[model samples]
Target: MTNSTPLLEINDLSLSFTSYAQGLRQISTQVLKNLSLKLHAGEVFTIVGSSGSGKSLLAETILDILPKNAHVTGSIKLDGAPATCAALRKMRGRELLYVPQGVTNLDPLMKVGHQVCLRPEQKQYQEAAFKRLELSDAVTKLYPFELSGGMARRTLVSTALLGTPRIVIADEPTPGMTLDQARETLQLFRDMADKGAGVIVITHDLTLALEISDTIGVFYDGTIIEQAQKSQFTGLGEQLKQPFTRALWCALPQNEFSTPKHTGAAGHATSSASTASQPESKRAEANSQVIAGNEPENAHDAAATQASEHTGGAGDATSSASPASQPESAPAKDAAQHAAQHASVLEAKNVSFCYPGSKHCVLENINLEVHEGEIVGLFGGSGHGKSTLARVLAGQLPIKQGSITFDGQALNPHSCSPVQLIFQHPELALNPRWRMKRTLQEAWDVPQSLLDKAGIRDEWKERYPFELSGGELQRFCVVRALAPTTKILLCDEISTMLDAITQAHIWHLLLDHAKEHSMGMLVISHSEALLNRICTRVISIDALNNHANCIEDQ
Candidate 1:
């Protein structure tokens, strides 16, 4: 802990949105619960949690950028003074600065240089920041639409870092960059903290965050359930007190690869101490299947048993298929024999693609195959054409050089698509005007079973895209893509925005459903660890793109 006073302090801050449903009925849904934290000068404080755990919402609330209908409560103090909406207006871009998640935050018409040079004198510092981030000087002359996804992300980050603010809040800042680049970018935040500025980073990559964050706060169900030193998350998570925290630690592919299950209720720490002694009946209590909204006979008891595997171990990140718990196994889902015998369901033969107007092709000579019951991981650095390949395979974009075949036939554009693509941003994929149920219904006739499997609540049907959390909306996206007609699931960085617990739950649900349905999948991601943990055989897209720039797993 540093001796410096907190530059930003949040005490029991809660936020909710007010909206009207149907014709004229008013509805208010609470999205954030009593969340509190303090960011001291010269410290990097990171908030870790699931997709809908209010991490981004927390940032929006702090910056006072939440939707107009959003209602906020509790005290928010900045520089030891009340940080009400009025006070925040004065500090929005000067004392307090925000770095949004994507380039969409960039003004489309504004020149990049103009965007970064909020103050004329800051241009030199901005250029320095851009160089540190490995950005080109020419990039400053382009418009928002002119830059690639990776370039846009770097611009957003550079724009934020150009300002010398007292406080910085960056949300999911490393999604589109390579591991080394992400590490370097985060180190800049740490350096800013070293210079007596407060930094708060919201991201899904806890492994990298551990290297820089001074303290970590675990957010779940719209609140912070646990907070601890960054040093506590090490060596099987023994020093960590929260069960979920330990579960997150173990869920990393480098760890035990087990994700602990939870009842989805707020409160309670996952204790190996309590679980080391629980009987089979108690452990059964742990597997009560909260993803389907089934609470155990004893909620607390379930938490202990479910998270107990981490008592002296790791990687219990929702360990549902382990023989120790779920003894029954499906023969067709077994990877050893089933995957070998299952017929090839989807194949891309020398597939290559380029954007409609661009002269250069992003992907070339990409040959990939997936059989029924096979989960293929496609991993690489951002801008390496992973997502472009997914688009081609899913028939969203036409292949320029090669052919894609599914179920021994060419894809039909008019009929129901055999390949379903789940994008990284669920909200963008969904219709802001339509309700969740309607969007899901367009893909499947009876979506109830799919909803239950994907852990989407019934109440979410009435909610619009903006009303739901990214994780919740993502659940809907998964259900829509895994419809009966889908032969191949193209998941393009789908869970990159989610937290560890939600990431595990989503993966568990997906793996279970895919195995049962014999649905083949191509999982596109930047995190090699995530692919290593969930995929049967991870393949590098670099093998297809023929690019010599990115590092990958074979």
Candidate 2:
């Protein structure tokens, strides 16, 4: 551990938000329960958790942004001084800087350079110099309206850094950034730590967090259930050593092991030991289900029984999936034909859209297409209208020029449906006061059979948005969108807020759903790996922006 004074400390902190309903006063909804942490100067700390785990509330409460009726308890100290909510508010933009998820954190109407130069005296930059750094000498003069996703992400980050805060709290800093951008931003944070600033990144991305975090804290059920060094978090056999942490440990990419100095070959040995601990029957079942489409329960039952028998023995299960365990099946010919037939479900021909307040077009002459049976990935620097494109495709926004067609039907600028856009943060999109059923019903006219088929049974109807997990709510939104019609889906940074494991699970579920419905989807993502795994073709909005630079890799 580094020998440094704690820059910020939270002691027994708790927070509750207000929930109001008919004929009743506001009811307190507890979010954080006695959360505590101490961050030293020149160090990086990450808080990892699932959605609705109160991780966000902790950050908000630290910034004193909890709702008016919300209750806060416990003491917050900054640089050894007693910190109060009033002090926190007064010191904002100086002592602490916050970068919220999505580029929307920056006001759309303001110029990117103007937003960054909010504290001209503190920033000590001439208007011209700032523009050059922000690449806004051209774009900054234009408004948030004209930037791309990468540009917007960079601008927001520059603004936060320009504030020169002692402690930076970033929520999903790399959510919608490409791999290179994500790596660059994390390196920037590492540089910040080197410069004697304390940085805290609150994210659900286990892989990114493991790659960057000096220390990791696991939050669950409104509590930090585990805290350990980065080595301890991902070291070999680390999972078997801590069964409670195993699920999370294995969920991340296996390549994130510490260097030889930390674990040496011991790490590999430990991983092997964990693998050897699994029963042969279970391994066979898992392989059969993946390669043969066997029932999950049947596979799990056989595996579990074998695992129980080999509970204390080390066995090699890699060879368990022998020929005998394989299902006797032929290739899926009709499935291939079905997938091919559903191709080109959504098409955008030279699509251009402009917001009411902006004089310049937000999305300039863009052409894109989504085929059935695969995810079409959208890539562009921020503010170039990735979300706007999603909205236009979903028929939520009207295009100033160009056309969008769904299933061979031309979509009028005024009337477009059959496409649904799931936002980066669905919780904000949902009405907190309404139950799931009311919200879904309001969005779609669902038949009884379809409702049952969607996996949203009667029990979930009464549950409000706040009652469901982030993944569940996101899935619910997709189901609701599909309820109206199931031709195509438009997802805009949908998994940006989810943890890696949950994000993976959601994507798998989406693929299954798409296959089941024989539908097409246009998915907007910053992660190239995700696109590579799911999309048939990757379209760059950057290339679209500069048509002369268009280059196809296929």
Candidate 3:
């Protein structure tokens, strides 16, 4: 049923960006190198890779939306003919639909319904799309900022599904969605492929990709290292050809969940084989010690054990027990250890919140607490009050009633907040006009060591938020939140955009820092596997709020 000739094809495609160096000298960095792929009608092709691997950039290149400074050397063909910028522009919305990664792509000034419908004639189609996605009719009137991360993602999908397109490129489209919602979205993509449309999904969630992708391209560094049928990704990934691809398969939480030592600079999988062949006992020990989330003991007790190991005895500032290769200064270590003895608490007591002009309370009587040295996971269904609560706790939104306190005091709005919020959409959280360096410096004078630990490169500092991939921009956001003054960290789907390796790496870095500095964290995400791996304990938003009751009554 699939077409013999590809619907979209790329030949020897390469992309690079031009940026300034220390002086006025300009340098070009090739982020995407010799990438090539084909999408056939009636098939779903997925590109899986690490963060900053240029998967999203390929979509931008196809849409001809890359910035002016970008230099591209590639031939993009559609229906066996060249796809020039003008031709692509002509067919952009109707023939070549795109579901972008950033929810910021939605116009902040417009209502959701207007953005999706565009014209009065499209209202019916928009309604149908919303219904199919399980979005309430009321959501149509809300602005982009009013919607939760999951709702915003579904809205973007609705926009793409409104038109009959020859090709659909969705970039990390299902991150904030619930499991059912994510599966439904993928099923929609499959249905589109069955209807003779070529669908390309770029994602970090390999488990979801395996469920729907017909063909999978393993992306690394900048290019496609290997291409294999979905069936080939099997036990131990023996049927897979490339080491990195095999590593990715084995790294899934359902699989071995083994972390590779390192993915080499040249896109080689040097340590994947060893990781896949790790002994069961050794792997279990590593997982238990690193994540510390699966222990049957009390969550706080488990955290205490991890802290003791990470800090090498309580109140021992001179102890060389840090998990990071680069240790903190002696005075900083002394202060952190002293603070650990009397941990601060971030608490919300009988809190309630409702969006302005809305009759229903999104969060009602929500009581939650995160203690220093604790990583608490918050789980909830899409469009629920999870993000709303996070906003209130971070002081981004004022609570309608009750109180939120840190260390037994009210949050001060006049000065720099002790709490920092890392948003789900990195693009929206950042300034599009400023370079990456200025963005980080805007919060604090972030050390070079912290940037390196977060996988940010020096060359990237010169680029703007729009120039970097979503995952790459996310690193800057994470680093910005880790300022010295920050006490409580609120993460809203922070790792959803990253690959398995990068996700683990970031979590590992954060866990180490939090445990060492006695900082409390509230991590909000849809990945239960991730929560079980990193969090001390997972709590459902329904358990802490009356929003579910309000919905049932409705």
Candidate 4:
């Protein structure tokens, strides 16, 4: 029973913001340029693209939530009639619903149950929504800050379920969820579309998009470059029209995992007709060689060789030096020997942690170690204390039992910590009032080289956190954590919000810098494929905690 006419339509929609330059001069930056799309009843349409490509902006525009300085020129139609901002506002809760990407969308002071239900009559619907999303009834009584990332995400989804709406817009809703949870969430949207609601999903995860979408729109440079049926994204993306679309498909972790060969004027992937026409086997072979050839022999050995070449075998030693501070002039053999004899850069010896009033211990007797120049992957299901362990290691949370140490010494809370954490939600971690430049430089004076590598532009420095997209803000967070004094990094799903190419680029730069400085990293993620590619060895949270059966199994 699909509708013949469109349920929602946008015609030649554009959006820009007015900002000030250096000397009281105003400039307009257009974020969405003539973007247009249609949503039909009983169809799930997905928009996939790199981060900062205006996907979220489209969602905001439809909801009539754009800021005061935003200039919008567009026509939004519902049921074949023009939909104004006032009309959108009036119909927002009853006829339109949204599942935002940021968990910060939840009001901080209000209880979760109150926010989800909103009215006394919605209590039953709220309970049902929470149960379907696997949230505990007790969660309703808690505040936003009291819940874990996955719990917070589920809470947001519950709000959308409390009403019957004609259109549902979900923006990047699956990052903090486990694979099964993410699949279930997407399936819920698919079911909604089956019930004659127009569903619009925005994400950078191609695998998930392919599974749930009826039509896929490739968004790039503030416009839809290509639109195709889900069936068209088959083996090698041969049927896809746009080169950037094919490039995005090939860049998945399970696929070629390679960047595009050519770029357009905006530095994005451009069409290479000749390359696209090549046989699939040849392309696969080339990609395999590229991946295999890039593996370093030994991270520390490479670091030692580079240091020796630069410093010419000079040795400098101090009494307080840690393992990562092995003399710059040390030869590869000596560097290896020193690493073998030294303690791990960060260690948790029989560590256990519990929340202030919770009866259950989230983490118990967790023995973990991250050595210098090692990338340790932590894999677990959602709400399994993976993030809690990262916070504990980074000293954001204190352990109730056992000991945590850095280079065989206790962490000093007074001074700046050598271990820094990069959170999954960059928006929550950053200051909304501060400009990007101030936020990036809050910890240290980051170098221009790092900014360039992270793709941070000078113009972006003038924007606040809300003005920039999630992926753009994440780049700043990554660069901020790479200060010279940092010895270890705790990355919790850091690349989940990025597109395939940007994800690969950031990882490449991060891996190189970690090897060069002999910095250890504890990478926490739910993607087994990603962990297999980047980690020295992946450890399960259940195994690390010595549990036979975990909460996820139940």
Best candidate, TM-score-wise? 4
> Candidate 1: deviation at residue 222, Å?
3.2
lDDT of each: 0.70, 0.61, 0.77, 0.76
Choose 1 or 4, whichever is better by lDDT: 4
lDDT of 4 by residue, 478-547 (tens): 9999998788889999988898777766766676677677777888887755665555545677667764
- Candidate 4 or 3, higher lDDT: 3
Estimate the TM-score for candidate 4.
0.85
Per-residue lDDT of model 1, residues 1-554, tens digit only? 45656788899889988888778899888888888888898889988876666788898988888878989999888878888778889888887889887545788889888888878889788989888987777777777755545566777888667667889999888876767788988998999889878999998889999999988888877898898987788798999887777877776555654445444542112222221121232332333232123554566633333222212111222443432244433542244343344455688888777666655677777788776666676766655677667778888888887888887788899999878899866766888899887897788875565555456677888878877776678778887887777767889878767666656656766766666566777887766665545554456666567842221110
lDDT (tens digit, per residue) of candidate 2 on 241-339: 443345455444232211111211111112221222222334333433432323456544443232122211112123433222334233443344444
Winner by lDDT: 3
Taking the tens digit of each residue's C-alpha lDDT, what string does model 3 give over 475-530? 88999999878888999999888887667557666766775676778889887666
Worst 10 residues of 4 by lDDT: 309-318
Better of 1 and 3 by TM-score: 3
lDDT of 4 at 536: 51
Clashes of each: 13, 14, 0, 0
TM-score of each: 0.81, 0.72, 0.84, 0.85
Backbone steric clashes in candidate 1, count: 13
* Candidate 4 residue spans exceeding 4 A from truth: 1-3, 261-338, 546-554
